[model samples]
Target: MGAVRETLDAVRLVDHHCHGTVAADLGRDAFESLLTEGEAWPGISPFDSPAGVAVRRHCAPLLDLPRHTPAEEYLARRSELGRREVQRRFLRAAGTDVFCVDTGYAPDPLTTPREIAEAAGGTSYEVVRLEGVAESVQTAGVEPDAYADTFRTAALEAVRRPGVVAVKSVAAYRTGFDLDPARPSEVEVTEAARRWFARGGRLDDPVLVRHLLWTAVDLGLPLQLHTGFGDSDIRLHRADPARLTDWLHLTAGTIPVLLLHCWPYQRQAAYLAAVFERVYLDVGLTLHHVGPARAGGVLAEALEITPFRKLLYSSDAYGVAEFFHLGALAFRQGLAELLQGRVDADELSLPDALRIARWTGRDNALRVYRLEADGPEDD
Candidate 1:
């Protein structure tokens, strides 16, 4: 316990994937609403769940309250401090030095990457969502025949933007990973664009989705794929990272493919990370939702077959700063407990345990995301 605490406490985390905190102060209902991926119930409260409980247990102390503070009291204290102060406290407490922010999820007002970096006293980079950029191109009215080139140019331009370090895709939510693994032909993409444009709605066209994904692959940047469990939009069976095996084989060695928030399929995700050189996995949103105690078990499963270098840390936390703090806390506590147990049992030496801890907490992400020597700026 002593060794584990010392090693983990000294490590600064690179939150490889997460979203910005909401810009405005939240009411109790508003705050609780962000706690779960599911729809809010008419009478039931979000605080009845594991993540809510974890927040009370862990994040309460950061807010200057006792551990296990009641949700009512917690929200009141948060409201009194105002949003900026709350963000400042949680982000700083997380011990995260860098944030790789995905700025595409919700329409809710949120702090920009620059703002989050300011709040956390860290540096931040952007992950351009492939789907979001494609939708924007579509909305801007591209001719069906020109959609492919237009999208290609737009995506390339986006990746070249200052601070844009990677790309992301929500294909798991849109068309799933069961699509044809081969890149679509220009004719096929044009036809798909025609169909999508004719339908006149959000880009759910399966063919176009495939086109978007393949384009991301060609961009040669780390691509974060939303896999496993998520909000109601995800089809559980289709969201499995293993479904992308065919695609993985096709895109192998091309770019880093990160599977995010893999919960039930974490073992499967671990298997992929084990077999595929470019594959990596992170149990971010899942960690805080499962709470600190159970987070060890989840991290253990993810680590079982995964190469130590293939696993990265992320919060997948959106709309709230409590998640940033809780995600880091859960990962630190869980990884420490697991590695420390191995050291105690003589399965791993102290030096090896400390090395593994540092690799998972910081070095792995730094190398994967190419953040080496790109340290955060002083606030």
Candidate 2:
């Protein structure tokens, strides 16, 4: 236990994928709403969920309260501290040195990348969401035949922007992983865009989604694909990362493909990471929701067959600073316990356990994302 504590406590995490904290103080209802990914039940509160309970136990202390503070009292205390101080407490407590932020989801009312860096006292970089860029082009009214060229230009420009470290896709939410391995033809993309434009709705066209993905691939930046358990938008069965085998084979050495939030299919994700040199996985959003007690089990399963270097840390935290703290807390506790157990049992040496801890917690992300060793220092 002493050795485990030493290794994990010394780790300064790199949150490879996450989102910004809410810019304002949240009321009880608002705070509870961020606790679960599921839609709210009319009669029940979100605070009754696993994530909410975990927050009361783990996060209450960071807010200067005793562990297991009552939710009502917790909320009252949070309100009293106000948003900025609360953000400061939780983000600093997480002890992350760098944040690679996905700035696409629910963009409004959240801290910008610069703001997140300022609040968290860490370096920050941007992950350009392919779908958001596509939607912006569509909303800007690109001509049908010009859509492909227009999108290409937009994607290239996005990746070239300062502080942009990677590109991401919510393809699991838009279309499942069962996409054709080949890039869509120019004609196919134009027609898909035309029809989507004619329908005048969100960009759910599979062809356009495919085009967007391949475009990101062509740019040669690490590409993040959301997989497994997500919001109501995800079809659990269809979100399996295994379905991506065909596409993974197609894009084999082009760029690193990161599978995010893999829960129910973590073993499958592990298999992919083992077989493909360019594939990697993270159990981020899943960890904080499961809380510290169960986080070790999930982390154990994810690491069971995964190459140590192919695993990375992430909070997947959005709209709330507690998630940032909770995700990091769960990861450190869970991983330390598992690795130390192996050392105690003589399955791994103390030195090897400490080295593996640093690889997963920070070094792996830096290598995959091409980030500097120290990242952009906080100004």
lDDT by residue (75-126, candidate 1, tens digit) is 9999988999999999999999889999887689888888888888888988
lDDT of 2 by residue, 1-379 (tens): 5687677878889999999877788987788878999888888987787898889999999888999899999999999999899988998899888899998887447888777787777789999999999889999988999999998899999888888999999999988877887899999998999899999877788898889888988999999999999989888888999999988888899999999999989999999999998999999999999998999999999999999999999999998999999999999999999999999999999999999999999999998998974555321
Full-model lDDT for every candidate: 0.90, 0.90
Off by over 4 Å in 2: 377-379
lDDT, candidate 2, at 99: 93
Q: Give one clash count per candidate, in the order shown.
A: 0, 0
Candidate 1 residue spans exceeding 4 A from truth: 373-379
Query: In angstroms, how far off is 334's CA in candidate 1?
Result: 0.5
> What is the lDDT, from 0 to 100, of the residue 200 in candidate 2?
82
For candidate 1, the lDDT comes to 0.90
Residue 131 local lDDT, model 2? 90
